[model samples]
Target: FNKYQVTAKPFFATDSCISCGLCEKACPVHNIRVVDKPVWGEFCTSCLACYHVCPQQAVQYGKATRNKHQYFNPHQ
Candidate 1:
């Protein structure tokens, strides 16, 4: 769980991010705060809601997701 928390932390690409605050709004647990970029809080559930909700795909979880595609299920 500790490793998961560390590695699963979401970060934003400065160039790609538009600072829309959508990631903060998408976080169900309210664990994300966006000032200039999204900041991960200790209470994050690692549900990846922020990653999927990003319009620019700027949210990334380490190197694993940096180059991958993002999918947002609008039905949810």
Candidate 2:
């Protein structure tokens, strides 16, 4: 919330990510990387595993999500 385009719209990755490499581990299809930075490779499955597992919620789908809902259910 600091000098990152003030608007109702949320701009993820507009801030510095901690780069913990959690997103890499969460990718089931291995279509992501966080070596120097977050990189997308090939056609993603849109699983959102990377998004849900992200500890800091840094991984995002543009303004498409607010990290509010999820599909993964450990109980199931």
Candidate 3:
């Protein structure tokens, strides 16, 4: 699935977001944009550190993720 790499949908930083910027700071690849609205860029490694560190749990990869232990890469 090299050409079909899993990508995150357009995730919205809801009001629950405290603007802590922790997600932006924690992003290893610096792919998360922390402006008025958080945007995921092409550089995203999908490490999920941002999602895990989010205090409000406002950031999400997509709608399919509802379980607590969802992982982006199965091989990893």
lDDT of 3 at 57: 79
Task: Give lDDT tens digits, candidate 3, residues 1-76.
Answer: 5344645454556677877888898788887888865778777666678887777777776654344653344554
- Model 1 backbone overlap count: 0
Which regions of candidate 2 deviate over 4 angstroms? 1-16, 67-76
Q: Relative to the true structure, how large is the alpha-carbon lDDT of every model?
A: 0.78, 0.63, 0.69
Q: How accurate is candidate 1 locally (lDDT)?
A: 0.78
Q: TM-scores of all models? A: 0.80, 0.65, 0.71
Q: Considering every candidate listed, which one attains the maximal lDDT?
A: 1
Candidates sorted on TM-score, descending: 1, 3, 2
Q: List the residue pairs that clash in candidate 2.
A: none
* Weakest 10 consecutive residues of candidate 1 by summed lDDT: 5-14
Candidate 2, residues 3-51: lDDT per residue as tens digits? 3432322323424467888777877888777876567665466667777
- CA lDDT of 44 in candidate 2? 66
